[model samples]
Target: MKKLSIILLILGLLTGCSEKGTYIKNTTPYDEHSVENVLMSNEHVKLAKVLLYEDELLAGIRVNTFSRFKKKAIANKIQKKLEREYPDLKVTVSADSKILLETEKLINKKSEKNYRKKIDKIKSIEKEQT
Candidate 1:
């Protein structure tokens, strides 16, 4: 009887200490779906991708410009808009083909390991370009 009571006490303690509340894994200041919507609202953008890493914001946009004069302008507009909304974050936007390609690769990565690897690669590229 004493042994059974001790076993029950241990089990009760273990169950009491176990996790019980809801844990939210996807924590970010910005809503990803909203960011995509805002980017897509611009008519020139063919593709839009956004990633938030800690306090940094990375954006990749592929645009079909009306003329050569508007190519750089479109990228600058995206940067300005994001900067206005997320002033505390380091916002970087690019229309560069390299960045767009890398974004596509990042989007396609299936597993957590591959996703982390791609994020690291994007960070390296951002460092080099900035």
Candidate 2:
């Protein structure tokens, strides 16, 4: 009886202390932009793109010619912060080929009449899924 009680106590404690959420198991990285960051950058935020795949997300932010270097640094810092905030997200880089073309296309459309409309469409889709 004493042994049984001790075993149960140990089991209960182990379960209570265990990791609580789903986490990305692999070391692989992904990249995605924080929409808030782009907004904070004011008009200097030339172009930014975010992509999600499975349990990972990726981001790429482009700056105007005069501020190219600083833009990259800021983007990198943001990426690191995001990774810390979302430890379960496999987060990483800027030039991922899978979404590179799509990102470029999105940036090009920024000046289009329907750009906001398209952004709204994307937001709607994300909203529905979440």
Kindly list the per-residue Cα lDDT of model 1 for residues 40-79, writing each as its tens digit: 6777776666666567676777666353357578888878
- Per-model TM-score, in order, reads 0.60, 0.41
Q: Report lDDT per candidate.
A: 0.65, 0.49
Clashing residue pairs for model 1:
none
Stretches > 4 Å off in candidate 1? 1-29, 65-69, 112-130
Model 2 misplaced regions, further than 4 Å = 1-44, 95-130
Compute the lDDT for candidate 1.
0.65
Look at candidate 2 and give me any clashing residue pairs: 30-91, 30-92, 31-57, 31-58, 31-59, 32-58, 32-59
Query: Worst 10-residue stretch by lDDT in candidate 2?
Result: 19-28
Please list the Cα RMSD from the true structure of every candidate, rounded to 1 decimal place: 17.3, 17.2
